[model samples]
Target: MNNIEFKHLILTAKYFTKYEPIIDTKTDDIYAYEALSKFEIDNNLISTEDIFRHLHHNNKLFFELEKRNKQLQFESFTENKKLFLNFDADIFVSCEQQSYWELFLNNKKDDIVVEITENGSDDETSANIMRNFSSWLNNKNIETALDDFGQDGSMFSFYMMNGSKYIKIDKSFLRQIELNYNYMHYLKGILTTIRLNGQKSIIEGIETQRDYDLVKELGCDYMQGYFFEELMIIK
Candidate 1:
């Protein structure tokens, strides 16, 4: 099926689900929101990477899909909670100011966090756009996060310079902490740098006791993944 057809099929399917907020134990606050999409056939979830790949290849199709997804999320969450909506940096950068910010303000300024995927845009242009977008959000007192930081060199640099209030470590890095000492050390240094710069570090993909222990030891500011709670459908 074509990209449009595929997105339409997924959106129309009744099996898609969204998870509840993942709270930070240390702060007792909801830190991140994850959206889980399930297929009706076998009750399988589509990976975040797959979703972004489809969006990258089919921009118009993804735009329409996201428009609907954002509306659903806005309807589901209360104004006291922040909704973490993942989107391509390019899509976010190109979003129409009135439509995007208006929807967010409708929910309240503090109740939205836009998590920009790490690999969504090319380096030079992406950096500039992210800087501009970050500044805009800062002006409006809206929170911005560099999602999946440490997945690549570009993402690391973007987090350091963009002045994002939160940095979400990629799940791949957390998954291998036990088997790879070097990687664990590398993540520690990254987390330290994030904290040193006055930003919060969120460890993603915590599916095991080891993952939880490591993040707790490192004093990660926030946590997300199956270990805490599976994504739940609000309805």
Candidate 2:
């Protein structure tokens, strides 16, 4: 879809249920529905990167969409459960934090976890910018989560310094942790460090019984994967 069409589609779109990992030993309650933005054209999700790129290119459209999303999130939270909002670091850094905080002030700030997804801008400049932006977010009581960590050599020191609250271990590590003892040990060390430093752990991309078993054994606090359920629309 073109940029204008894509913007309109996402602004008016409803949320779909994406899998969210649950605590260990949980079965029926192992997953939760996360909102997924979709376009009406053939009813498919627009590429997340494309949406952000359009937003970056079109300032007016970006502000409008952000305002609309903030309103929708506030309204939805009154009745719906907590929300894990996906945020591109580039878009986040570009926007005014005061505006976002004012919009969400009436709602529970802790209930809103900002997800910093992978595949966004990942250069030195981008990383430095995000570090500063994260510092601003931290002051506002907004939790920061580094989505899809361990995929690259971006380094975790920035996150630690910026006081990120959670780090989502990339799915690849979870997939192989069961068979690779050394890998598992490595992960355990990482998890231990994260915990020792007072950060939360989220294991993503889980899709099997064995995967769940391994993460649970490793004492992961949260999980998200397709094995529990695919994304679905709530309304």
Candidate 3:
């Protein structure tokens, strides 16, 4: 889509934030919430991935929409829990933009974790950019989460993971475990390493009692997905 079309789409879209709770594995209480964006035009829902893919073409528009969406996410959330916000790697372009976010996120720093996500290629250059972005967030005293850990084609860097406060394992691992029971062993090893490094691990895609039981037994600090509750609109 051209800039004009993208601009019009943004103007006409009805945006909403759906918060999915991240449950503490032991107490089963909500430890945090991940704010997911939802968009609609003419009452028909639009794929967020599609919207972001288009947004990547223009960093200016990307950050503009990101600012609006994140503002709504923070405003609509009344719970006194940590909020995880996804930051795509491609948007970290200029120092001016970094300053704007640092100012914008000042008050909310204590209650937020900026999740580093890659919506595009995972080449070495992209990985370095992500590492730099994570460092910037860290210097600002904001916590960071390495999102989609171990996903295919997603960059997995020990340098980045070591600095992160949280490591969120990808949801596809559930399917991998189903295909090969030994994958659980591999996952358990990873979890052990995560614990050893003093970082918490969040396992996603827990959709059933069995899924919950297995991952909880395998030992994840937190669990998230459809098993506990679906995405909820607070207002």
Candidate 4:
């Protein structure tokens, strides 16, 4: 299934998309639900990563697939909860101007946060594209989060024009924080800088009390991963 015959597979308006809650550690309530893509075929769940990687060589396929994912997510939206959608910087930059925003503006703009991955290439063109797009999102009362914001030296520079209300501390740094003072210290430094810049920090991959206590002591605004609850999927 890795090499999906995506061209042959009909891409519907609202395909198989899943929503996972990002819990607020302070309130112990869900702050928002992130839209994820998954394909279920013959009692098997196929991850979006399979499609994401396979279609990189075909720009048109990638954009259509991602657009379909976004449509499904918004179609399933409940007014009470904010929706967080992870977007591909490549497809985001290539799409028609304000295309998605036009679709979203008629909805509750404040209830949406568009998350762009930390792993995307930060070339001048990509930066320029996201910089403009992010500014537009901010003006529309939409927030942005730099997801997976560690394990890369370029992240700080990446956030200047890119940073919004949140910075998701990558799960890599969350691993073994108590056992490794090195990890703890680095985590502290990252959160400190992020706070100083007026962005809330989300400690990702907190699956144990140790992870919880440590971030709590350090004053992380949010936490996500198995420690709170395994991500819930509609299917």
Q: After superposition on all CA atoms, what RMSD does each candidate show versus the true structure?
A: 3.5, 3.7, 1.5, 3.3
TM-score of each: 0.78, 0.76, 0.95, 0.81
Quick one: best TM-score, which candidate?
Answer: 3
Q: Least accurate stretch of 10 residues (summed lDDT) in model 2? A: 16-25
Model 2 segments beyond 4 Å from truth? 1-21, 24-33, 47-50, 53-56, 77-81, 94-97, 152-156, 160-162, 176-181, 230-233
Collision pairs in model 1: 19-232
The residue pairs in collision within model 3 are none
Model 3 whole-model lDDT (C-alpha atoms): 0.85
Relative to the true structure, candidate 4 has a C-alpha RMSD (angstroms) of: 3.3
Q: What C-alpha lDDT, on a 0 to 100 scale, does residue 208 get in candidate 3?
A: 88
| TM-score of candidate 4 versus the correct structure, residues matched by position | 0.81
Q: What do the candidate models score in CA lDDT, each in turn?
A: 0.66, 0.62, 0.85, 0.69
lDDT (tens digit, per residue) of candidate 2 on 74-96:
45543344566665444455446
Residue 228 C-alpha lDDT in model 3:
70
Question: Lowest-lDDT window of 10 residues in candidate 3?
Answer: 226-235
- Given candidate 4, what's the lDDT at residue 187? 77
Tens-place lDDT digits, model 3, residues 143-185: 9999999888887788889889999999889889988998999
Clashing pairs in 2: 16-232, 17-231, 17-232, 21-223, 21-224
**Order the candidates by lDDT, highest first — what do you get?**
3, 4, 1, 2
Candidate 4, residues 1-235, lDDT tens digits: the string is: 4335555463632257667778787777888777777776445667767666677667667777766677677887764788888865666554473576456544756677888663255677667666666666677677788777774544455544245788888777866565677777777887787778888888787778877777778787888777655656663
